[model samples]
Target: MDPLDSSISLGAASEAAAAKEDVESPDALLPWARFSAWLECVCVVTFDLELGQAIELVYPLDAKLTEKEKTSICYLAFPDSYSGCLGDTQFSFRLRHSVGRGNRGTWYEDGDLYNRDAPVPLQKEQSHLYGYVYFRQVKDGSVKRGYFQKSLVLVSRLPFPQLFRALLQVVAPEYFEKQEPCLEAVCNEIDQWPAPAPGQVLTLPVMGVVIQVRIPSSDDKPGDSPVTPSPKENLLPAPIILPSPHEQDLFQCFQSMLIHVQMLWELMLLGEPIVVMAPSPTMCSETVLALVSSISPLKYCCDFRPYFTIHDSEFKEYTTRTQAPPNVILGVTNPFFIKTFQFWPHIIRLGDVKMAGDLPKQVKVKKLAKLKSLDTKPGIYTAYKTFLHKDKMLIKRLLKGIQKKRPCEVQSALLRRHLLELTQSFIIPLERYLASLMPLQRSISPWKTPPQIRPFSQEEFISTLEHAGPQLTSVLKGDWLGLYRRFFRSHNFDGWYRLRLREMTHKVESLHLEVTCDADLLAWTIEKSEVEIVDLILKLREKLLRARKQQLGVGEQLLERLERSIHTVINSLPNDLQALLHRH
Candidate 1:
């Protein structure tokens, strides 16, 4: 045989042995024979600027079993960072039998797993003790892509007998959600060509671009929020979580942010003008990426900086390792490449701040000062009152974006007042607003709710319950119920319920301690008798009124009940409140 053919055969044999663990001898390990194939090795993960890149392992993260069990339950798995963008990626596994372990049989009509035009149908049967079994790779290693790495892990999975379920659940699907976009971006490119006619050669999809940022000097500050390495993060800055099944409301903030971005983008498209004020290195970049991605496939002039300018390329080489950032920034070499940034028709950089090209005029430049005039944007003030996220710094920065366009002074004031109220809501991190509020979220969001009314601000009370929001969540959670219960059993105040219950107490006390022998109770007996049946009935009416005051929240039904209680209490009183024996 030719030396090269001999070498190829020998190399193939050795590779197969390594896979089967043949060094131990199959005869010594009966009932199991292994086969090995290197197959093709393509990147399990890839990236594009439109979607980023990666390889994903969509496994049964909740599965759990012993290592030995896993061996019998066989499966095929790849390491990944998938967020499970592929909704239907799971496949079935089976055991095939043969007359002889070494026998190779015809496996498929089209051939093995390499059939690109057909589904990879699987076959396995009960042992006849005379055949060779072959396993096929149904789905090959895929080039996954996404904004984050978790997508690979989310969509891909380990083999059957799923023992890795628990491992998968340790993380969340959100960790790999973006993998769909990234993977799709890469996969679509592999089998796709740009739009074209029957004979005209089509253009290829644009390859991904890289972007790097240079903050110049953005060392961590003393008290800045640290970005955890995990792909998913809890909203609470302190790491506290709500009771099971409860999630803090983020609708207000997120919705508001989305609306603002949508409007800003639309305005820019309409040539309405833009205002760039203090652009944060962190927020500005994140905003740009998300904003661009959301409105993808749209043409725009993107002016991004070169690699060397974003960071000190020489310093990065010296360190050999640069810190990873929270905001996304893919790099080519010297500067980080903004993958999405490539979609823009042009890019404006700090380097161009002094340039004389038609760039500034060609691209709509809205200044930050102009946006502040939008004081009346209803959406702006709405979020200040409702957002439940603890990332106040992010909010403040985002708020700055639309502050330039706000209008409506009184409305804005009311909105701020409402914000103060919600900021101090019982469920939120009230600690931040403690100095700013009292028992009640005394103030409102600056642009919504009522203005801060001095004198009565601290005394913002609707009886013993809420006279505020329609939800009245605060009163339901506070001590109002307990206080109302205490009110039902008045200490010395004459009330109907108290007088009625007094009979029960008297009977019990009497039954336990004979009335004649209870000498100290003589004065109490005289006072209790003073209620008299008719007056006790009238006191009952007053007691009923106070009962209504408890456990009230901010609603029309509650308000009506409170009014009736006040009326009943006033009618029961023999004189004005001034004449009452329990007057404070």
Candidate 2:
């Protein structure tokens, strides 16, 4: 059978199965519901000598974009070194935008209304749009610049670097050859993709290529399950591929700095401002992504610019020496940044990938002056001290594995698993402590408003470290209390705490409504005075009004039942009391 035909057949089968599932289960998300969920739009960015980077085209014509957004997309898509570059380059960057504006309607206006997991509108709305750009520079005598420079960009909310890269591999070449019509066909193919339902194995056919992947679930843990088939097992032509943090080779990028892995992890956790200096945009972006994702499952709350250049809007804001550098990680190829970001506390300089040999270069810590020197070595330059001690045994094991000629994949897996475990070990204690802080579900009263979550206290959390902490289960140990103390001052802790608190508050609110709906109103009112009964009725009415106003997913039947229950209690009261309540 022709490969394209096979892919088409597979897609049809999957769609039929999905439709059947939707019929059987009314809650199933519709196809293309999250089409914009992963990919929002495809943009073509070109570099003009006078205009710099300019937006050549944006697919789907109706993709709402602001002037500022277009400018950002242009610059990000075409890297700083585009003028001097000769070949192809691929990299990713995060584009910040106002949440409710710019391509948001593409997702929300569709069947996305049926998506229960849609993000709730935020008061101060800001969001990051990840851009995966494939840039190319080819010889062209027709143009005055002597070379043609343009970039094909994939704008998405998802951070699936590998998936997007694969997509670009198909879309970019054809689009460059056939232009806008090629993009139109690609978009049509993409429209056929199923909703990105987590934990399900999806065989997505994009541009005649059948790619299979298992979207990681919220509960998925690193090293807990095998995402790929084992070597001994038969490999399918379209095997289910596990998503990666980024498309870059993490092991290769960080091989030189293997010894400083723990310190780097600590710095990332604390949201310290660090700069990565590499030989190219590819290396810079890859290293930065790898560092940020070191603490897997714990989302890095701080901002990171994978390939930051002097032309970026925020360049001045970040480089202002009058104030301390903000908590962000920047990756750059130009050596000029070394002088500009000299005030930055931590900087990691990576060696040229081409010059790398079988043995990885040993990393060393250097002073500011040494870093500034033209002949300075590639290593970590930082004044930051880690609260936790290094895991000598783990490092020895990894080094031994490398010496024993282990596969690069195996070594990378071992490192990633270790980092994940380390992060989980640190987070588990906080999670347990936070769980204890929740007001007991039974304590939620129907007569009164839900209780607020207890404020997080650093001292209180620390006191429990003796009985319940990472030390209890973690193989790596040191001054955990001290680490937690410092962590309380970091942005990661603040972000994590706020998110957890909001979720808990929502949970409590949901529980309160359920209790109110199922409350034994008549029985409770039996011993209550007229004043008390009236107050309870008023509270219940307020809750109902609030639920409706907020669209809290409360069913009409549930609200009506509660209303009937309230009326029943009121009718049972004395005539004069009832009349008084009615008038009020």
Candidate 3:
């Protein structure tokens, strides 16, 4: 389109869409021709251009257009109805070919279009667009004589300027949705703005396309440059402001963003065909539409626009534009342009931009996240309580030791604490609470509520004869113990008094064995309890008594010593042995 084509300009919003002359391609279009065949399958079609959008084209078979006018008309690429628009939209279009309803075979009008499966003759309205061709006249050179208005009714729905952002989001999904975000905070000294330093370049990823940019050299250099001592060597290369991967892509994304904005600017009441000035060539109209269409703003209120563009010139030198101010972005002079177009495209190297490493003394920075954790059970946090006060010792002695010995101990990943109350396995506790709810006299404890776990009833508890949690588990295997404990918690304990008594006897026998020889050795070697002295003293007293009372006749003095010793032992306890024996 010419820079200022009146037709390309947007007409009054109230004015109806322009009537496009119906023209067909230049060629013999038989009833069963290729063009007609393609048309047969064209459920929808549209012509799009950067200039504007068009819809509802009425083509008359006899209608014709001049060559210049035909060439200027935008290309309608697809077919679809105009459901709606974002806001004030501009469209320049012409309908060239169309076929309406009312065909002879398998033809259904309006609601019945879905049932058509066979070819049929088309009605006048059904055959709205004429299948015609364009060719230069052999003699008169009259542009209008080439093809009559073909019976084609083409309708296109151009996006409203307001939807420009949405359109880009739809069309070029990768660029808009996936562009890298830019970096911030070069210094606390000044609000972040583009630095105008030489040799400053940063890598950027736009929609995945990567580029290195240099801050445009500032004829507007900052007042602050690193001070050199002793008139030292060369000034340090001016800091090149670089973008994180996200920032690079963000910059590229900004280009599309501009196009989107320009389109909306029109709808926003800044009516004008969006002009994108960059060193690169203009994009095809279809491409522009594609970029816009990728985003579906019809749903989300915010999205990307495809038609937006920033500066048209490649950053060949320090350029200034009110649209983009150095105060807004640190202009980096591109170095790749100096080498060749193919090698160093879209790259700028700034040498004087402020160094991000340099920080201001005034502002405070907060720490980011403390880091990672891995726990499968939601709320069961790792509880390793130690009496040790030193963290270093705890880590070295406990954590490291456990890791070394238990290679399969829940890997480092599975160690997180849940901040919320645990609902899981609470059933285990709940069942216990519910079973205890029975009336005081008739409370029956279930012994096997959970199949894998058994709760220990009073009977089972008596069998252990010690602590239910620790001692009972010692008698049974892990699985049986789990079942016993679960059942004991859930089932009612009734009609098992005799079994309970027997279990108690077994517990007593077990305790008897524990105390005999084993308890003494265990207490001496492990627990170091002094209870072993009681049995030792009893045996010594028996040996001394037998020796003193032999048939040879024991001495009275020795007998007295023996009796005194026995009295001493008996006096140690509240009850005397003589009284205990007498009571029995």
Model 3 C-alpha lDDT per residue in residues 441-546, reported as the tens digit of each score: 2122211111121333445443442332332212212233343343333211221222333334333332332222122222332332224334534543554444
List ranges where model 1 is wrong by over 4 Å.
Answer: 1-56, 60-264, 267-584
| Cα lDDT computed for each candidate against the true fold | 0.26, 0.75, 0.24
Task: Quickly count the clashes in candidate 1.
Answer: 113
What's the distance in Å from true for residue 149, model 1? 9.8
Candidate 1 residue lDDT tens string, 370-413: 22231211111111111122334434443443344333332233
Note each model's CA RMSD in angstroms: 28.4, 5.6, 38.2
Q: Taking the tens digit of each residue's C-alpha lDDT, what string does model 2 give over 42-78?
A: 8899978898788988876777677777878887777
Task: After superposing candidate 3 on the true structure, give the runs of residues whose Cα lies further than 4 Å from its correct spot.
Answer: 1-34, 37-273, 276-287, 290-584
Q: Give the TM-score of candidate 3.
A: 0.15
Off by over 4 Å in 2: 1-34, 82-85, 98-100, 104-125, 221-223, 226-249, 354-357, 525-584
Q: Positional deviation of 285 in candidate 1, in angstroms?
A: 8.4
Q: Each model's TM-score?
A: 0.16, 0.83, 0.15
